[model samples]
Target: MEHRFDLLGSGWVSVECDPKSYRLSSGNQKRALAIRQLIDSAYNPIDWQLDFKSGYRWRADRLSGTLRYGHEPAVDVKVPWELARLHHLSWLAQSGDEKSIREFRNQVLDFAAANPPGYGVNWLCTMDVAIRAANIIIAYDLFISQGIEFDEAFLGEFHALIVAHGKHIMANLEWHDVHRANHYLADIVGLLFVAAYLPCTDESNAWLIFSVEQMINEVERQFTPDGANFEASTSYHRLSAEMVVYGTALVLGLPKDKKAILGGKNSFPDWYFERLERMAEFCVHVTKPNGRVAQIGDNDSGRFFKICPSFDEAGGTFKEQHLDHRSTVAAINGLFEREDFEEFSGPDVALDTTVVSALAGGQKITSYLKPGDNPGAMGVQITGGVDSGLSVLAQTFIEPVDATVLNGLTVFSYPDFGLFIWRSSRFFMSVRCGPVGQNGNGGHAHNDQLAIELNIDGEDWIADPGTYLYTPAPNDRNAYRSVHAHAAPKIGDKEPSRLDFGLFRLENNVDARCLCFSPDGFEGRHAGYGVPLHRHIEIQDGKIRITDLISGTKSSKVIPRIVKDGTSLRKLWSLDLRFSPGYGIRD
Candidate 1:
C-alpha cells in the first residue's frame, strides 16, 4: 500500500501555553533544561558497557568498551539515541518544513517496517521503547495525513502472528502485564490502537479485544489507588500516568459506532481519572527542586530522559501538546486540560517512570533510614480504588534488614536454586559482600522485602519491577541490581545494626504497620546470641499507627513524626545490636 502525507500547517504549529496557567518559573525552566541536557549527554548506551561474552564473539578492546558503556544494543545504544531522537521529532513535527516532514516520515516508516524479529530485539538497545513508539507514531501520522488506504493485509498478518503466538506473548512477556512505567503503557496503548483499528470480523477481533481489555483493566487496577509504586520514584509515576491517559484515550477514541461495546462514555471511567490523578499527585509528592525526578528504585544510570514518541501517531500529537504544556496531569476531579496541567506542574517535579528514576529518587529521599516499629511481611496485594489511587504493596522494615531479606527472598525468589532472587519493581540499596554475611543471606537473588505500593497518593503501586535484562552470567544481570543503587548501606559497616524489620505502610494520613512475630526463636548461627526486642517505632502525621508489641517488651511512647533531616525522634526506642566483629548489616 502506498502511503500519502498531508502537510497541515495549523495542526503542526507549536502549541501556545496560557501564560497565567502555564507559567514557567525560572527554577522550573532550569530544571527542565537540566533534565533535557542530562538526556542529551547520556543518550548513548555505548557508555553502559554490557557484557556479551556468552553470545557474540568480539575483540578484547571492543568488549572492554562495551562493558564500560553497556554496549548491548537493547540497553545502551539503540534506546538512548532512539528516545532522544524521537523527542526531537516531536519537537520538529511542531515546526519542521514540509520537506523535512516528508523525509522524516519516509525514513522512520521504512526503518520500522524493516526491523529485525522480536520487533527489532537485536537493535533494541540502540532503539529504546521511545524510538519504537516514535516510529509507529510517525508512520501513523503519515498514513492519517496522506489518507493512505489502510493495509488490511498487514493488519491481518500481524494479527495472525499474534494468534499463532498468543501464548508466547502471554507467558514470556508477562512482565509487561505488571509493568507500570510509561514505556510498557505506551506499548499497551499501541497494541490497543492496532486492535481497535484492525479490520477483522467480530469472531477474530473478540479475543484480541478481551486480551487488550484485560491488560487495560490490570493497568487500572494495579497502578492507582494506593498511591504506592514499586520504585517509589517520581519519573516512573509520570510514565505510568501517561500510560493511563494513553490507554483511556485509545479506549475512548474507538469509533463512536463501536462505543457501545466498551463502557460507553466519551472518556474513561471516572475512577480511572481519579487513579491517574492520584498517581500523578503521588509523583508530585516526591518531586524535588530540579525538574529531573528523584531516582528512587532501580533507575537506569547508563542513559537519561531521551525523548521518545508514542506508537500511535495521534498519541504523539497528544503527547507533544501535553509536553508543550509541560506534561502535567491535573489535580483530583479536574478535567485534563493542557492549561490546567501547568498549574499542577513545577520544575521540581518532572514525572519519571523508569527503573533508573527509582534508584536516583531512593538516594534523595531522607526518610528511608528512620526507625519504625512496624515489622513483618506486609500482606502482598494488587487492587484499585475509587479515589484514583494506585496500590503499590511495599513493606518497610518489619524485621531486621537481614531477617526481612531472608524471609522476602525465600518467598519471592526463583525458588529452584535459591541462588537467583527477584523482587517486584524498586529493589534498590543492595550490597553483596562476596556473596556472604548480610549480603550473602540477606540481599541478592532479589532486592529486599516484597513491598507493594499501597497507594500512589492513596492507591496501590502495582506489581514489581519488570525484568528487562536477565542473563545467566553474574555481571550481565547484576548491572541492573546492586547495593550502590539502593538506599541501603555502601560503607564498610553502615548497614543498620538492629535486625529491625518493620514496613511503614502509608495511605495519606492512614498507615498499616506490619510486624512478624518471630514464629520460632531467633536461630542464626552468626551472632551466637538471641537478641532483644527486634522492632521500634517512628510515626509521622496524625494517621493511626500500630506497633508490634513483642512478648517481653514494655509499653513505650513512640514518636509520631519521623523527620527527613535525620533528627532522632524523642525517646521512641533504641536498640543495642551486637554484631560479631567481621559481619555487617544492610539497610
Candidate 2:
C-alpha cells in the first residue's frame, strides 16, 4: 500500500517542542488528569459521565450505562462523550510523558475495538466521524514524529479505522438542501484529508475526486459574494473558513498533473484561496476591538478544534471558546503575505506552521501579491426623535443626501448579506437589513430583520439573542430565534420569518435594505408583517436615537423591543421583560 506522505509533511512538530507553533490552543490538562485518574481506577474514560444531553428528545445517562449506544432511538450521544473534539488525546500528546502517550494509544485502540466499524454513539453522526478522523490523523502524525512506535498490526487497525470512517462519511454526506453549513463543509474536508494523506488506493482516489467537486460547489453555494457566510452566523463562518483552508492546503499539495486532472479548467487552489481571503477579511471586519466577533446569529460553540482559550472560561465548556479568529488571520497573512490585514491583528496572533508545512510539502511558501483593501469606513450621526426616549433609528429618508456627507463617516454595507456596520470612536453598531437568509430556508438564520445591535461606551448595550440550542428543546430553540429575542419590533405578535420546519429552518424571508445612508444616520425598511416597517438610527453626542415608522397601515401597532441584561421589567404602556444574555442563558 502506497501512502501519500508527500501531501502533509513527514511529521508534525510536537506541541511540547513548540507550544505556539500550531493554531490549536493548549489542552485542558486538568480534564486530562481527571480522565487519567478515572482510567487508573479501571473506569472507561470514554463513558459519558456528565449529562450534556438534557433538552434533546431522548435523554439518558451514558455514564450509568443505562442507555445502550446503538440501541437508543433518536438520541445523539456525541454531546455526552464529546469524542469528536479529541481534546483528551490532545492533552495527552501535549504532556510528552511516556505513560500518557501509552495511555493515549491504549485508549484509542480500546475505542476502535469496542466501537467496531459501525456501532455505538461514536458512529451516530458522520460529521462527528469526519471530525474524529481528522483529529486522529493529526494525532497519528504527531505521535509518530515524537518517536512513539506502533507495531504493524496496531498501525493496520488504526489505518483500517480511518478508512472505515472515510467510507462512512462518503456514503452519508450531510448536505442540507440549500442550507449546507459547517457540518457539510467539515464532511468534505475530512474526506479530502483522509484521501490525500492516507495510503493511496482506488478507493482513496475515488473519494478524492468526489470530495474535490463537492468542496468547490459548497464554497460557492455557502459563501456570499460579499465574503460573509450565507448562513449569516459569525461562528459558522469561521468554522467553514477553516474547512476551506484545510481542504485547499491538501488539494494544493497534490502533484501538478493530479491537481490539474482533479480540478479541470479552473484552478482549485486559486478559486479556494480567493474565497479564503474574503472570508478572512470578513472575519477581520466583524471582529470587535476586544478581538471578539459579534455573536450576530446562531452559536452552538462548535469548532474544528479548540485553537484558543475558552472565552467563557469560568463557566463555559472547552467548546465554548471564541472562534480562533486571530489564528485564522495569521494563517491567511502568512500564506498570502498580505500586510493590510495587520489592523485586525491581535496580540495572540501567531502563525501555525502545520498548515503551511502541509501546503508546501517541504517547499517554502512563495510570496503572493496582497489583495485589494476591504471596504473603507464611513461615519454616521443620529439626528431626530430625542424626546420620545424610544430606541428609534430611521430607515426611509425622504430627502436626498449629499455624496460628500456619505463619504465622511466609516460605514460598511454588505448588500449581499444585508448587513451594515457604522462605527465611531465611542459607538459601534450593526444593523440587519436584508433577506432572512440564503436560499431554501436558511437553517442558521434568525428572525432578526431590521434588528440592530449596539455597542455604546464600548459595551454591548443592545444585542441579538443568540441561538441557544438546535433540536434539543423546541420551545427554547424557537424562542431564541424569534423576533422577541432580538432588538426588533414585533408587529401584532407576527414574526418576521416563520419557523416552518425543524429547529433551524425558517420561511418567509423579510426583504430589507438600507434606503438611505449618510454621516447623519442610517435609514432602512423591511416588509415582513404585511407592512413595511421603517427604522431610522442616529448616533450623536454619546446618545443614540431610533425611530420606527410603519407604512401602509395604522391600526396594526408596532412595539419596538430592546434586549439588555440586568434591566428592570416595569411596565408603562406594555409588559416589560428580561432577556437572555447568551445561548442556554437567561437573565
lDDT by residue (1-587, candidate 1, tens digit) is 11121111112322211112322334344432332232222121121111122222222122111332344432333222322233344333434555555434433322223221232232233224322343345344434444443345444433443332222232223233332343444444444444554445564355346645655565554463433333332334454554454445445445644555454644334455445544544443333222223333322221112223221256444321111112433311122322323454533223322111221222211111125521111222212221112121111222221223222221111111111111212221111111111112221122312122111222112222311232222352342233222222122332222222211111111111222112111111011012121212222231212222222334455343332111121112211121111001111
> Which candidate gets the maximum TM-score versus the true structure?
2
Each candidate: RMSD to true structure?
Answer: 18.3, 10.2
Give the best candidate by lDDT. Answer: 2
Residue-level lDDT tens digits of model 2 in 104-144: 66666545544444444455567777877877776665676
lDDT of each: 0.30, 0.58
Badly placed stretches (over 4 Å) of model 2 are: 1-43, 48-78, 145-148, 255-266, 269-271, 309-320, 340-409, 424-426, 540-542, 554-587
Off by over 4 Å in 1: 1-89, 116-135, 142-187, 199-204, 231-233, 261-270, 301-335, 338-340, 346-587
